[model samples]
Target: MNDSGRAERRETVAEHKRTIILDAARAVFEAEGLQGASMRMIAKAAGYTPGAIYAYFPSKEHIYAAALGESLERLKAATEAAVATGTPAQRFVAAGLAFFDFYDTNPRDLDLGFYLFRGGIHPQGLSVDLNAELNTKLLATLEPLRVAVLDDGAGADRARVVTADVLAHASGLLLLAHTKRLALFGGDARAMMRTHLCERLARGNTPESG
Candidate 1:
């Protein structure tokens, strides 16, 4: 009834439409990928006209970026939660496993994180700034694991290396699992991750033998 109430209602409606566009965009991206997907496809998936979708997102690339941003946020939350109750070493392992588990369970999110499209090696329409912003968001999701490695008493360089190792290992494992190739490596991706983290912890604790 009031002007303020009407404005709030409008804001809510706008946000709802934005969410609808993003949800449709995600499915379209997954199906057709960033290079192959179009605004029209996303609009059809969202049950809106192309003009209506444009009111929310300027391009399919922007929609993909927004979807990936949300996925990274969820990943960060999952990593933080897993690292909350463990010892430093345990927390380090927990963070790595959390990363693996997040991608392993959400294969589409993993695809989004990969930053590749159906017909191209790179996303074409994303601006440099937008790509960098998304990269920063993605790396932020791994910050917990890096911090946990540091808390486990590794030096900064060592922590960085360990964090990278975890990310690379998890990515490889998830790729194998997603493509049904994990059976070639004993078929237990999580167990391999656990073992690898434990080995890294042991090496960190071992005294150098001069």
Candidate 2:
């Protein structure tokens, strides 16, 4: 191969290895969480020696960051798909349910995204803002909700407030359902979301509603 071709081939191989390491890292992180999971465990899962994993990901924290970023992408996709169809109000309902359902099915992902164990600290060789990009990606998923909630001609600030409220409601529901606390109220995530949407709609349509 030409020199340039050889370089491209090497780059491709490196990317492939990184992808493999990240795939294994996600599985390990899912099973063991951030603090408990180890690079050796991830290497074993990836069918590589411990030293091999270190070549692609210098530390478990970097692997965790990559894994969480992947999860965040899926979460964003799910939320976007949910809000893609229906009327504004219908889209609102779909968006809320999507958030609940995504987390309900992938509780570990919820923990990863919400920083259950990772928290605000950074490990060696990882940026303090390692998860910052994922947070921005997650936040961008709120646009659909903003569009669904705001009345026509609504100001940006109002959209922000409404979107925040909707997100808070959805996040709260998922957290409760994940902890099995929602069961005490005789509802699953879907039921809670549906009821919350109904209440919001009622208040929105009422003559004296804010």
* Candidates' C-alpha lDDT: 0.84, 0.75
Model 1 earns a TM-score of 0.91
lDDT of 1: 0.84
Using lDDT, give the best candidate's number.
Answer: 1
Q: Please give the lDDT score for candidate 2.
A: 0.75
Q: Which stretches of candidate 1 lie over 4 Å from their true place?
A: 120-124, 205-210
RMSD in angstroms, all models?
2.4, 3.9
Across residues 1-210, which tens digit of lDDT does each residue of candidate 2 receive? 999999999999999988888888877766776777888999999899998888888889888778777877887788899976688788878877777788889887777776654433333344658757656777777767777776433566766766677788888887787778988988767786788876776566333456
The segments of candidate 2 whose C-alpha lies over 4 angstroms from its true place after superposition are: 1-16, 117-127, 151-153, 205-210
The best candidate by TM-score is 1
TM-score of each: 0.91, 0.77
